[model samples]
Target: MQHSIPPGGRVSGFRLAKLLGEWRRRGARHGSADLAAAVRMLVLDGRLPAGTRLPAEREMAEALPVSRTMVSAALDQLRAEGLVASRRGAGTWISLPSGGALVGGADTPLVGSSMVDFARAAPPAIPGLLPAFDAVRARLPEQLVDHGYYEHGVPELRRRIAQRFEARGLPTSPDQILVTSGAQHALALVLRMLTGPGDRVLVEQPSYPNALDAIKAMSAIPVPVAMTDTGWDLPGIAAALRQAAPRMAYVVPDFHNPTAHRMDAETRAGLADLARRARTPLVVDETIVELDLDGDPLDGPPPVASYADDLVVTLGSASKSHWAGLRIGWIRASTEVVHRLVSSRTALDLGSAVLDQMVLAELLTEPESGLADRRRHLAGQRDVLMAGLREHLPQWRFDRPGGGLSVWCELDAPVSTRIAVVAQNHGMRLAPGARFGAHGGFERWLRLPFVLPPDVLREAVRRLGLVAAAVSGGGSVPHQEVEVPVA
Candidate 1:
């Protein structure tokens, strides 16, 4: 195939050489699997437009200083995957399948059927949950022989949860709490009670995608405010409040999802003041506050709720701190708001499972409950995982978050979806960054969960490094030699 360099451009640098070396190494070890996966992802994510001509094998190999054989293998793999097609004297070109072509046909069912998913933000169930369940079963006969299923949740559970919040500096009363199945359910009920179709609500950019979907499903418009690496963009948020005049602002103030940036007390107070001034309700998701990985719990500032008033709707859950299977989460608000939510919840489900509520109450009230141990375990795991990433892929940029389940890493190039696809082929599922964004930005980011065991995390990062090198066009070399760009 004949090729010419793009006008006013020339490719020559150590960067080019490193990219080629990385690609070659990945091809030799993984046999063009990663490169092909990258090509397919580029097509799938619309980064490489349909009919875009690919560089010739010999030219790419020469430019990158790799063997033509490796380039040929990569091209062949792409051809086999139907992502690219070659014609006589035309070289290779991308071919994107239309939306209808994604499934077997237009009639194929693809919406609700379960696909291999790594996008969920919740953590795996803890081992202690089973014992808690057994204990609940043993004590159920005495607790539930006389029945009362009302909206205030189980009395014992409410008191225990309120006490836990109080310990964190968020004053609460049993009458102000209403338990729901999970955090998502709680958020849904709150939205149902507070807002309606055509109402405007504020959300953060790269916010929880499922929550965005929920808002859309309810016919509400979501106004996005940007979040920075340090924390919430208070100026931008205030501007959005003024411009959008949203009915409510949903925020993940503690150990936020996707970015793991916690809002400081000053920002929290400022936001509360803004909400109060604008007459906008603020919904705070504190689901991950108990997952702190840095310092002793005694060192951190008071909980976010300590800075807000009746305008704030604080949501907490046992899912992240304890076990997701427990399906126990609660909303803390004024008594009036609690009653409104409870009344609205009656149409959704009769009540949360009595057994699970009782189990959570018992667990939270335990003198030596499992929270401290779990925190210690998570802290150890986070260190191990971060160390692995630093050792294996130094080119990527990431923040060692204070507390959260995942690390948000930014790749040197906009090829994270490709890397995820390649990793999945090697038996490692990844959450691509675009899944976190509202309008499909963040193509250069990926979320890696550090909640896995150290050994498993090591393996995952090793495979991930291999994938990153391949996408970066770096050929075979030790991970230490790979030039991963932090920016």
Candidate 2:
């Protein structure tokens, strides 16, 4: 693939410090190595993209409150690794992150590679998927009679999606649905329609990594409200909505990503009222709501849109629910909003893949038990993961998530970035907690996906234990350059 260099942009010293959160390890004498490791992780994660200019050592030292000598040492290490480059007059900037191919855990094997993809919280296609495809193939003859373009999605698929919402206790119509390439694509359209550069978007403190990337890419600021131990902090969200007066609020109320917290009905009602009062549309992401492991998704709390339909823009995807290969997601909102989105969407693409939409529509027609098998499989894998964690790394702690695909593990030490840096050698790819945070500070947290097979999950956890132990022991792991994919 051809690449275009991003225009050089300089990051502020204080901003850089925030991005490199909690870099120093506990009881560590020298912070230089830790600082370098943190920076390396950020660059590899695309947090600090190539062509991004860095603050001078003295400025960075003032922001970090570390000695200039330590700052110089960290820069030296990064420069030696070629992760960063500096010139006499040009100062320092990030080098392009390329070369050194590493295997990734793509569900369908995107390439010839081998590694446990612990970062992506996605599962393979369900057992019913191929049958759904065959069903679509049988009906394909008539579908070929007309032009395949569906700006508002195939009508039957849209109706099926609306029916799912009704099952979840939300009154949705086919008019409210506008299908797109994926949830990420749906989000981009919403952002383009509702916001402009410098607009504020309310978001959870630790959000979906790609969502955060989308918000930043749009040049809109993210106003984050921290999550409590139990779930969302409604008061905090209300305060942000009032003070920030953001253009819109992006939320994952159902089986929230990484943390896997589902909002209660009462809280959902309160949030809807808050958004209504503030006139801020809540962009609710229910991409993984169908993956409810504890109970039926329909039996779960009512869809947040039910509370304030006009104040909500719901994004749904078949990626996590049925298959990522489908790449089909849709937006549900007021008909006016849907129409506006369609007007703006033509600049992006014509419509989602017709065949994929048909497959999902077919799957949606199946009984609720169609997804029961998926939940059971995930629950069993979750059990395998928790058991492995207890056996190999008992010190790590995480709450049993009732739904969603991952376990949010809290490390005994502030070494998430360290653990990730070392895990590559163990043939495991892990997403550090910093990826979830808005400005990067969850050093003690890591999100571990249980989407892999039972045996793979068990082995992944075992390797993770070794990685955690190595980092905690303060033994230096040799640098192994590889790409870190964010899902």
Candidate 3:
């Protein structure tokens, strides 16, 4: 039997035959029920997703060495079960039924649980984490014996965080602070407090995927405002706000994830103005603000919240700057907004861990704390990864991101998904660019983290180079001769 595999899915005709043959060998009936079950398992296991078009009956029958009658019968059975749906002239599509319609049994592998996941945006832990944990242990007794776990958050920690923000030029008050487990939780609390389900929210295109997921989880509509390689498209953002009339907008102004573009001062001011004009709340994620990898870290400009007090919510997290396991994050907003957020947060974990907040407070107040060590370590790692990429896979085009954990690279071809699969086979994980975009765009790009150690990053790049060569159908070539400009 011969089958024509889809473009992105390179499962060959022979492979399909083998899969079907194995199913037959298991003594399952060769009818449509059995075939539908097999295909359902594949879809549920993430090998296929909704809207994936199956081959034509003639093509599938030829590939499976089955009669066309059998192919048609199997498809009909699948359609009846609502596991597959067909449209006239558009061909048949495999779709999971909406809500509570369980087609497969408990033994089937779940969609996200079965893949070799590289879509995570988390950075590796700082080298100081072990020592930080030790330090936390030395002071755990007092925290454990404390009676009340909720004073909003530990007082000492809140004070320290406020002081740290002040040192960075953003004046904050401890009364305006509320600690949370992570940035995601903080964002959720803010969303729940500010807007209701079905309210519209504006987000940047090719932004953080988890933000989109959170918005959708709240049943909010996410209107994506396109951004550019140079910086935020202020006019585009304004247009999106005007058209969508969103209740809020989420912006990652400093060293944005996936894109690595920083919002310039002028753009920041314009955005604040835009939000004020639109009467929409603006949430700025400053998680990657302090990770400057380029020249001298000049405190560039005031935070967006500083520009517009009533309409902006500034969020910060120690996860990116310090350790993800620490799970400490805060929001610096007006007292009114802080009170509302805290009120909404009562149902969500009753406040953050008391001991973790205390530890963060100690780290923030210490003159030569783990935060300083983290900054220095990340700078060195970024340099190491950049140098390795320069020496190895220079055909890929990427800028030296000024301050961010990852470098966004544009490949010559739209094969990021393919390259990711091949790299995983070679023991390297990769984030395909499409995962960062809505409507499955950014197919020609990749996001590579420089947060790993020098040696591990070097090895990963070597493996990535080999995978790129394989995907490109060419042998390794000499590094492209280009001047390495200081970012």
Best TM-score among the predictions, by candidate number:
2
How do the residues 121-217 of candidate 3 rate in per-residue lDDT, one tens digit apiece?
4544443344445587888887777674673678888788788667767788998887888888888888888777899888888888777778888
Candidate 1 regions off by >4 Å? 1-118, 296-299, 474-487
Across residues 1-487, which tens digit of lDDT does each residue of candidate 2 receive? 1111122346789888887778888445668899998888666543554456788899999999899998999999988887787767667877632452221121221123356788889876665565577779999999899999999999999999988888877888899899889999999999999999999999998899899999999999998899988999988998888788999999999889879999999999999999988888899999999988989888899888888988889998988877788899999999999999999889889998999999889888874645776787788778888999999989989999999999998889888888888887778888888889888879899999887655456567777888887898889866443347777
Query: Candidates' lDDT values, in order?
Result: 0.69, 0.82, 0.69
lDDT of 1 by residue, 222-290 (tens): 898878878788889999999999999999977788788887778888888888889898988888878
Angstrom error of the Cα, residue 142, model 3: value is: 3.7
lDDT of 1: 0.69
Worst ten-residue run, lDDT, model 3?
100-109
**Root-mean-square deviation of Cα positions for candidate 3 versus the true structure, in angstroms:** 18.5
lDDT of 2: 0.82
Q: What lDDT is reached at residue 115 by model 3?
A: 26
- TM-scores of the models, in the given order? 0.71, 0.76, 0.70
TM-score result, candidate 3: 0.70
lDDT of 3: 0.69
